[model samples]
Target: MLERSTKIESPGVLKAGNPNKSLASWQGRKTEIAQIQQWLTDKNTFLIGIEGIGGTGKSMLATKIYDEIADFPKRFWADVSNGAGFSDLARQVLSEFGFPVPEQETQLVEALVGCLRSGQFLLIIDNLESLLQPDRQWGSLFYGDFFQAWVEDGGNSKVIVTTRERPELKGFEWLTLKGLQVDEGVALLTVLGIRGDLTQFVELVDGHPLLLRLVADLLKEEYSQDPDLSRLADLGLGNLRQLLTDSQVVGIHHRKNVGMVLVLDASFNRLNELQKALLLNISVYRGAVDSAAAVAMLPGSSAPEIEEELRNLVKRSLLVDKLNGKRRFDFQPLILAYVRYQAGDQSEAHQKAIDYYRSIAKQPPWKTKDDVKEYLEIFDHFYQLQDYNSAFDSIRICNDFLTLRGYYVDKVELYGQLVSKWEEIGARENRNYQAALIFLGNAYDSLGQYQRAIEFYQQSLEISREIGDRNGEGKSLNNLGNAYNSLGQYQRAIEFFQQSLEISREIGDRNGEGASLGNLGNAYNSLGQYQRAIEFHQQSLEIKRDIGDRNGEGASLGNLGNAYNSLGQYQRAIEFLQQSLEIFKEIGDRNGEGASLISLGNAYNSLGQYQRAIEFLQQSLEISKEIGDRNGEGASLGNLGNAYNSLGQYQRAIEF
Candidate 1:
């Protein structure tokens, strides 16, 4: 049995109080607060949903309600805006309750529901809109299941969820939080120390909380010396308000957003050059922006200068300072859209971001998750600049890392986009286009879509031959052989491998020759030609050593072990497999590591060491799941079952 750790540590601190202190001093929302308090106190109401548009002060209202609800024995706040998923939230909750969280998704959900039912806890899930799917549904079935369970079953606990979009769920009171009342908006302006009769100004902004705050901040800074309501035209509000009012005839949605855009535009015009440049440049990023990235985006600006500018933007409400684990900056969705709109034709900025990310990356075969993330950004920047060739090149450089990490679905999508772009530009004959086809084929092969894989590989082969590219032709042949091998067509695979080997030798491509030999060995092993497979694997191993290809050498060694194991040489197989495992670990090739573990488990099982085999297979199963290798996961489960069956533990075997 696997000795699973039961220790539980919180991924984030669960302080049981109002987390949004920034809005503590702000007034308004008394009526909203009272209604939410009633829902919290109501025994029948288990879930309270607060929904609104972007700038309507939903979070602020939730914070107020949270602070006022002091009767609950437990309170937990989770901010989902930083891209935390359902599992992350569950882990935090379970840890807070001091319960061990299971690794499996279903088990985790069950544990969380049990915890929620066990107490009268108050849970506030903020920015739930961030976790909602693009189609306005729950992003995960687990989310739906968890919430549904909470509603169907009686629980002492109450849940508060705040979102820009309302989720369609039953057994809940939905509060459509709108803009503040005119009196509340005027009070906010007054509190901000704006010395004016701001009733007309507040009414014009439709009592939008964030817009009122932003306009006040701008006025406080720019017009502090004069501080008169008559000089509002100096800040462009006169013409801007007219434009927004006239545009209300377009649509209600447009009318709602036009006020925000006009306010953002007025605020943007007041920024200094560096501040404007920083916002425009960082707007290209799809996620949060740290100071380091901010500084990189603006060349000739020192770190201190950039930090000051970032703070200035945060103060001006143009950027949100996300003080989670790190002090990073992000924009509200509307703000990001506004800045990106203002940054039309930001190809130069995108290129700068690309260069900065590339500069920080370690040379290819990126080992860290952070490196892969940066490469993803680089690819996006290239795509934004319409440099599809460079974008695909970045994808090519990170292809192995992506594969090892089980990013096949994402890889397929990226390559598909690149292929469509190439076809659009009539560049199907380009080398990158051929590479994209091969990449798509490889992704499909990894995903077990062998027929689709064959289609793309065939297209790549045709393109390679048409362009007279021998190396690409050899690669296509090798990939096709691998796909056939996966499909159990060993003889067909061998024929493709033989052709690939011939091309490699003719082109003097030693690396390609080694890959072809290794693939041939795999096909022969599948055919039960143990001695012949060993011979081919040995040749491939020698070439890998000569070329210093550690990953390939490890793969060849594992293949040799597999062949030996098939010949009943269990001890020899163990030694070779162990060496292969070590190499894969050193190279950070998680996919290879999992394969070697599975082979080792099989060898141990052959020796009748069922307990040891179970341990190895379990480890392999974890790695397979981590790297998204569905085939490896199935193999690990099957191997473990065989070991359990050998021990006559039929029930345990069936569980596997």
Candidate 2:
């Protein structure tokens, strides 16, 4: 038998109406109630563990148990949110249950147990995980003898503990509570004037009380109309997630304290400018990007400093990711949206990309002149994408290379067109129609503007041939092949590819050889010659591999996979895509990886593996959105819709 303490009623604090109070007029959680009541009534069980997700009304559940069990001599409530030691745990429980506080760890549990044995008390321990916290020396505070002693000997009254984690306590009856069912969630929502059908929604989230309440809050705030259940059922929580920003009221009691939402704001205020930028920069990754990739995205930081900050985020639970693995770290979606809103004001990402492009532009041209054409090529890509700010900035920086030193015909043409867009000019240079004609031709060919493409390629090819530049002539032929292929003129495309291949092989340019081979593969693909297309692509892949051109090899592999897919060889297609995906990730080619994911998802969709298809497509959509690839994102979204539709989840199929 255990000792006992003086009789006392469970403390009934009348501070429920206080503005900052966490107390609620609780109602549901019947299962949890029954489980704990049984645990308390059982004589064999010494420890009772109550577990639930955040905001699942865990505190209220614990509070109710404290209030209801009246016959115990004393009742104590210990908040273990900070993780307590055995000594601290005994002291807090004793204090809350109206037992005298013991002065030292050696006598703390004995004093409490003696009081209990004397027929005085029961203890309801709050935040059970908090008792796991250690002192500054980094040692466990409550793992051994005392914990066993409390349960085995402190007999007369029972002890109950609540935690978010599944604490492995011996002789403890663990009761895990997830979120409410569909009906319960809806009731909770309806009570707050929130609206949603939620009938067809796949409940991936464990009905965690906080998240349910958040969804309910979002429904009330954003989608208040359209009574047809079909419309409501069609939408998923993802839509709600998008609409639910930081300021909006979240889950169950939408009016309750939004303390957790403010955690990021406090975290932001605590960090310096550099740390803020570093954190925000890393947040833009496709998935849990490894530390090395994060460093690559941000150029200036040292490894040790970044590692320290990353460790800080992990400890604070701001950035959740496995410390090891390839796709290891991700900022929580809710947190990421907030960070994106904040980062737009501060990051120098655009400026950095521009600077890097300029540095690459400064590299010595192999056969071409110092025309700064490489920079123009990159600059215009950004320009056409409406990344105008970076384009304009780069155009300003490399105005020199675009002018006097530029002589390569393609570059000269690009320079003329590029300078024509600028409003400012000190010494206006004459436009060389010939060079503009050449560059514009090549650009049109690259863009699949075949008529425009053909016109430019013809013009450039004639000039290069006249100038005795066989290499330029060969490049023009390659563009001619690409343009013809786009126009469904496979015969013409093959002719051009053949000529280009001959010239490339004659010149011993391995890169040019791979390009010509890839071009021929494209021609074959266009003509529906699946086997021939794959063979050409494999030839291109070999050349790319030998030349150490990872980009070219991945492209060839992707093309080969597309061929296999078209032929209904799903397994082979998947294999090729997986290979391409590996290379893309290894080389940090997010855009390539996104495309591969889409292709793989499409293959899976064809095989009727809808869940896996949607999974991969969803990942693809996220990656594309992160990399600013709207086209890829849209394609993935459409595929995801199809997947849901095929699964008979019609309501979740489409979103306008």
Candidate 3:
């Protein structure tokens, strides 16, 4: 029932840094690899940061690059954990880099700096965040005596840091990662032997590589046992990755997800005050927050403080720009979740931010443009509330708001709503679509979208003609003729109007025929064929008289009088004009009566009955004023002016 998709693929693969170090199996990231290699070779580059969403294969890329460099006599791996102290990181780096570690802390530092005198080497630091944990006494190694000595002396090491988040490194480079391409993603899944169709692939993996691998491993296991069984039954059946510190095989995606979380928790425990606060705020959201909005939400924080904080976060590889216009700061899901957990202890600020947006959604629109937006916010709120009826109504109001602004989308959406409503009432397969056909046609006409209107009108005519509903067929044809008339195709308009008139006359629908005749007269009038216009107007007037349609008779009589007046038959015009006025008066149509009275006054003046003309014109002008017909009143004033011009009383005529 849905239409085809219209999304484009990214040009490269994203790095989803994992907890337990995994083997490299990557695709679509050669460009990124080449860029990193070039930067590392350049003298100006100090650190290369690896960043991406969870399951984006960040760790895999790092290990692949590390494996390619076989000549490095020593390669080191450090696990970032909550309990990881400065001493632990120093121990891993010192032991793996061929540096001698002594039992005494001071002896270890001297030997580590002595080992640093060695030549060019690659330092692969994994989970760099664990270095800043509160328990890790980051100051002891970062700024403290032992680590301070190494930092001052080490000048030949190329450090590459990989974290689920960017860590707060004082001197390092950063690279934010993206996800894998569709084909690369498929290739990754295929390597695991869960070969499946598009529908199945999307249903199972949803482009999350770890979940894809996990889901595939489960299905593969199930398929190996019972090849004939369905694949969906194997979902949520296995754990693929565990903590770097723990060795456990599980049977759920959430457990693997949580395992990654624990790794992040361990890393965050090591940060100093400024770094900790930056990471905490950066992980505070799922959607990007405007740089200003984020700073505003930060209590007691100044603009310069927020900008500097965010810049440090970016430099550390914990936060990056989303490239989306509305938001400036973005975080990985896992990092955000961990930060949120930390902030959960102080829930007031977070809850207030949510309330601010909700309040914006509830504000009343003060302009037509804002009116549409106001309802849209209400619509989203109701959708979040799971109140479909309220959502539907608010959206409907948005449609109307768009309509008043000449927007086409809201009009199309409105028609869709009406169709849905009809279906809800069991009218989808309508046997009597006379009402729907006319309404849809008229709606299309209002938009000047004539094709749909013509199609609907044709279908309506066919159905009404088949059911012997002449009135409906005539009405549809008249509307079709109006559409042609609007396009300046007078001949086609005449053709459609004639058909409608013939049907109405055949069905004894006098009022319908009269209306059709009035349309035909207008078409003829537009053609400048005065004789044909008079003929049709006469026929319409006769029917209105026979059917006792006083309003219709008054209109037809007035039109006929205009026709005669245009022909210079002044007396005949007066007769018909007076006749039109009597009907207009009988029906209490002040506008119609005023117009008729103005015509009578003009005719009387033409007959040289000045006093009578003035009396009738004054009466018409008063009625015109009462009925808000300025044109009619103006015509009466002009007639009175003409009467006084003839009598040399122009001032009195203007006053009258």
lDDT of 2 by residue, 173-289 (tens): 878765666666655545655434553331433344554444443333234563232333343323433333345655533322233343345456656676687677765433344
Off by over 4 Å in 3: 1-416, 419-433, 443-455, 465-468, 565-578, 588-656
Clashes of each: 0, 32, 18
For model 1, the local distance difference test gives 0.79
Ordered list by lDDT, greatest first: 1, 2, 3
Write down the lDDT of every candidate, Cα atoms only.
0.79, 0.59, 0.58
The best-first sequence of candidates by TM-score reads 1, 2, 3
Q: Tell me the tens digit of each residue's lDDT in model 1 across 1-656.
A: 00111111101112222453467448778888889888877888898999877777777787776676778877778876543446557767887777765534446667888898888888899777655655667643357777888888757889899887766678779998877789998988888877676888777667888888887777777878765555668888767567767944475345657767767778898899999999999987766778999988877899999998899898788887877677888776667767877988888888888888888867754433355666777777787678898888886787876666545555766787788789788886798898889888987887678999999999999888988999999999999999999999999999999999999999999999999999999899999898999999999999999999999999999999999999999999999999999999999988899999999999999999999999999999999877656557878998999999999999999977
The numbered model that scores best in TM-score is: 1
Task: List model 3 lDDT by residue over 135-169, tens digit each.
Answer: 33342232244434544565455657665544334
lDDT of 2: 0.59
Worst 10 residues of 3 by lDDT: 1-10
Instruction: Tell me which of candidates 1 and 3 scores higher on TM-score.
Output: 1
